[model samples]
Target: MVEPFRVVDLADWTRGESEPGGAEEKRWFTAPDASSQSGRWLFKPRRIKELTLSRQRRARGDAPDLLVRGEDWAEKISYELARLVSVPAVETELATVVRRGTEEAVLGSMSRDMRPERWGWTPGAALLAEHDDDFDSELSRGHSLSAVLTVLAPMNGPVGTEFHSWPAFDVFAGYLVFDALVANTDRHAHNWGVLQNPTTGVVCLSPSFDHGSALASGNGDVFRADRVRSGAVQQWCSRGVTKRFDGGVAVGLVDIAMQALSLASADARRYRRDRIVGLNLDLCDDVINAAPNLSDHTRTFVQIAVATNRRRLIDALH
Candidate 1:
């Protein structure tokens, strides 16, 4: 049996920095861990502001609804699932944040910074913009897979001992595969990028991050239950797409992932498919079942969605 993730209380931890550009609030702080490199972690609370609202709800004598948006557990579970398939991804942990004077604490996930010391993190939009003078990083109009691949083909995989010989495009294909499995529809141009060493002027792909938008995290419990009861999870997963790619047209997650894989080397393609083919459903169930603060409906819906998409990806890849 998989154990529940321990929740780190950050009420006393001093906020060191703030992260911008996302709809939700984010902060950077030094993690309590000793082994972490850089010691910097990003704290992103769940999309909903439940702490203050819950106090008001309680004052009104109503039930306080916690786990608003479910992104915290979604992020942690996605991290574990990524490990199951050997996808190099940023590590995330369940955490809580407290306002300075308030006793109420907001629940969130803390993502370990993937950037190595002295390396600069660059987003895909910036890379595309640099690659083509006409490309606009702010707009999604020109963020196509071909353009992304053309830029990645000449680069190396993420900077790590394990990724020494891997090509950037190869690892990127795995990222798409992971995205398809999770029904992630938010891989916009700003979502992915590379890390560059200032001294050597060397660049490499960065580990996948920012998965709080996956696994239907933004939807409420009622929506998840309705979809599961009506047996529409698979259909819903089929419709999940990130329009930020391929000229902003809505493309199915699985379709886009398969398209990316088709452009990769044969060995890399085979590796991704084999990982899915050999995946154990029970292990996935353990991960979901072990997740904290999830409703029964959410557990059932995510399990079915993953299994459904797994079948879809396997069929397409085979």
Candidate 2:
């Protein structure tokens, strides 16, 4: 089974106070080359990831790679999209970012005190000292796979997590539609998870996180038509869809839902298999049906993804 994990080290990034309680925040860091540091950290854990709002505001042409792409709604939009698409990720919540006082920075807690062994939490103390001079340059491998699984995981589980439990047919189909409408392309390893609560016996996947890349005003890597044109490539590289904030106004809610329809159509193979990835399909259907409160636009998007998935689900569920 895949183990539970969180980021304990921030030495590479600035030593900022995470949100109250356990909500992690991005701690800014200076790049070895001050200018280059502004780029992006290709691969990162979504729960503990950080980006500069101020830097995003200062951006010139294309949106800065590291900033939350949308405004305050970035989290809201992405979270709803995940629910619609049926991908699993961390719970999304707003948290504060604070630069730790010098005393806290210098006389940090010891690693042993932080308990790196139990729960697999790396100590937050020494991270400041050991982090790279160029912190943002670090990229995680297999981000492509991460993106695909964000919403379309195999339900068979990735290598790290062996337990697999996708839901009943109706539920899985509903989420697929939700994700397609939202166009959540940033489905990488750092954002999604596979785990269960022991007492509840519920092997639930986390809700979506790090969806700041959706619905932008310019062209982004994820928004490119060529990426999903070839059915095989969309299925094969479905795992790595980190959006580069490339969407123009044309690709908003309407465009995204349409794109999802086409993308899913190209590779019915993957969509057909992923209908019940994380939860029971019955529960999924219940959630979608109850979500009548979702905005009309969002609802329309879900309808499109689900309509196409129903037939496939019936054939497979039997």
Candidate 3:
């Protein structure tokens, strides 16, 4: 079982503040372009000097800041599960905020700015632009997975080395497997990217982030309960499709994973198969159960959904 690196109760951060001030203030400039109904704010806490110092030392940058999302817990759970499977994922914690004198708890995930002084970050969209002149329009119309693969497959090698000799393709394939297992439908162009070392010009796939849409985040408690009671978890999971690839075609997540796996080189396919087969579901259960703040109904639903998806993925490999 994987334990969260940290679990913060936000009440500590908001205790004395009568209103949103000090560290509770939002940094409006850092918001990324995405469709999230929940309000997001870049929070820099004043009390956690240790956290701030650690983030700065690791990234060789400033203090670590949190991207807090109101009324959302999916990111926290998703981060935990991703870490459990040894996938690169952002760290997250549950927090309570006092806004307008009303106390509410939300999920706050940590982020290291990709734009360090010496390094740079590139979104998948920019990477795709290297290959397709009409990348933007093509992306808007959907079915752009092939275009993305075309760009990423070639970046598999070490800097100044043979491009075809590396495992970057396999690493990305592993991400698809993670998405399928979690039923993440939002692996959009902007969601994945590469971290580039400006000094060396060496680029590697970025760690997975922005997973607020995974694990049926949009489903209500009542709907999730109904599905669980009816034993329709598998059917429901199968019906989970991604909007990232198909604008309106309703392409299933598992189908997308299968397609990506098939397109991958033999070595990449074998790597993904071994990784997925080796994941520990019991550890996943422990992580889910450890989230005391999560509602029982939601927890139960997540447990069943993960189990169903794991079986579905294992079956797909055969």
Give the candidate number with the greatest TM-score. 1
lDDT of each: 0.84, 0.32, 0.63
Best by lDDT: 1
The local lDDT score (0 to 100) that residue 237 gets in candidate 3 is 88
Clashing pairs in 1: none
lDDT of 2: 0.32
TM-score of each: 0.91, 0.31, 0.71
Q: In model 3, where do residues sit more than 4 Å from their true spots? A: 1-6, 9-72, 96-107, 112-117, 137-139, 157-166, 246-248
lDDT of 3: 0.63
- Total backbone clashes of model 3? 1
Write the residue-wise lDDT of candidate 2 on 1-318 in tens digits. Answer: 222122223355333222222223333232234432332221222231234456546664444444222222334434433544444433332222223464332211111111111223211111211332322212432222123323343233211222123332222223334444344454333434433344543333433344544333012323333333432222322232334112211222323333333343333335534543333444333433433223333333333333333333333333
Cα TM-score of candidate 1: 0.91
Weakest ten-residue segment in model 3 by summed lDDT: 14-23
Per-residue lDDT tens digits for candidate 1, residues 81-177, read 8988888899888888885666568889998888888899889998898778878655576688888898888788888836647989888889899
